[model samples]
Target: MAVDPSDKKALNIAMRQKLFAVATSRDVAAFEELFRYYGPRVRAYMAKLSRDGQFAEELMQETMVAVWNKAAQYSPDKGNVSTWIFTIARNQRIDHWRKANRPDFDPNDPAFVPAEIKPADAAFDMNEDADRLHRAMETLPPEQLELLRLSFFEEASHGTISEKLGLPLGTVKSRIRLAFAKLRTALEDRS
Candidate 1:
């Protein structure tokens, strides 16, 4: 049970011989040796693929069963034992994936919820507020308006707006701040 995993050549030779013993004589002891050596490894591999420990454990069981049933078919000339075993594990995962029963989508899920409907009067007030904001924006000097438009509507940073408009960075920040103040005051007065 204390295999020096680092001594892979020895392990492979042992596995080959044990597998041959299992194949030729149905030696349960030889099969048990192979299982002890490779069981946890195959389970770990299935865990990574399935992301579910119990399901991975199940897949590992299926894979080992396959290894047992197909032991006689193995050929050292074809490939090593580990590759053959892992290949069986991979196929078991794929087979389970193909038949997995995913839960039905929840209709009441928050992501699927429709937005709340607005009352008629509240909708009208929102439109009026938008109009008032638009008029306040129209009152801004073209330069300040352009800076605000580039900064917000275009989602450009103050530094980017400064570069695009060829204005000092400080000036761009100041004008956007001033534009917000002017709009706020104008909209307040209108209301």
Candidate 2:
């Protein structure tokens, strides 16, 4: 039977009343009637959003199940039955897309696995590394140490440092490289 397009709002409100009855009284007939009216529409809505027949079918089933389970949560003051069911359909599609796109994390996969590091241990290690690096920087020649500090602490480019220091670009680059090499060697020896 074709419902007049003009009567759609009234029909939706009537359906919601039936759903409320289903919620309060476990009315199987009311639920069956709601499923009959909404199932195809929900499926079509899911199919349009997903563009996958099998997934849409699955989501349609899920939406109906949610409607059945959560019927009690529906309030007429909030929306009509069509609005509530379509919202459920939209959410089901989102959930399905997330599940499909989410990467499967395997605890046994070494490449993807995360190491369990204690927060205190990590902070202590970071402090120790910073102290070692500072000591290494102190051992560098004054000019080279200044270049390293400007490049790192000041976050200046080599060309900018060269301009600021009024030195040749090549000299600034070589000094920074030499400083890094000395620091690396000092840290490696300590390790």
Candidate 3:
């Protein structure tokens, strides 16, 4: 007797459910699948939010490690896997920001902290929607993300960016507003 493709799909779904269970129960193979599917995208998102390539890489690795440790708590019905994972990545980014403010550290002292290390395969997937959001940043005309990156990322005053970019204050404000609106629409269309 030959097996039907729909039967195969049913089996696959069952297998995925079982995998999710095993993943929740600390099985390494299941964990590896989750990492393979989501890791690069998470890294890309963190990379975009960081100060530079190295810091972003470190934060991305930290985010994935947290995902591994926290996988057991994931609730499939609560949300899709990507959103839940992105939440974890965002929280880690916030934590990195808070930690950046420590006072009076000596690199040679025993109390001094070591620099963060990035994952060996921290390179992002060339094309995940989440990853594209990072690259889609570049899709916006340079003047646009620049104004918006400064406005949101650096919290620079419009006046400040206007001075830096040599544009009229009104033009800077309009471009940032339009850039954000377009990005929102594009992401919504994808979702």
Better of 2 and 3 by lDDT: 2
Estimated TM-score per prediction?
0.51, 0.57, 0.42
Q: Alpha-carbon error at 75 in model 3, in Å?
A: 1.7
| Native-to-model Cα distance after best TM-score fit, residue 165 in candidate 2, in Å | 13
Point to the candidate with the largest lDDT: 1
The C-alpha lDDT values of all candidates are 0.89, 0.87, 0.72
Give stretches of model 2 more than 4 Å off.
Answer: 1-6, 106-191
Alpha carbon deviation, residue 113, candidate 1 (Å): 36
Clash numbers, per candidate: 0, 0, 0
lDDT of 3: 0.72
Worst 10 residues of 1 by lDDT: 95-104
Report how far residue 2 has shifted in candidate 1, in Å: 7.3
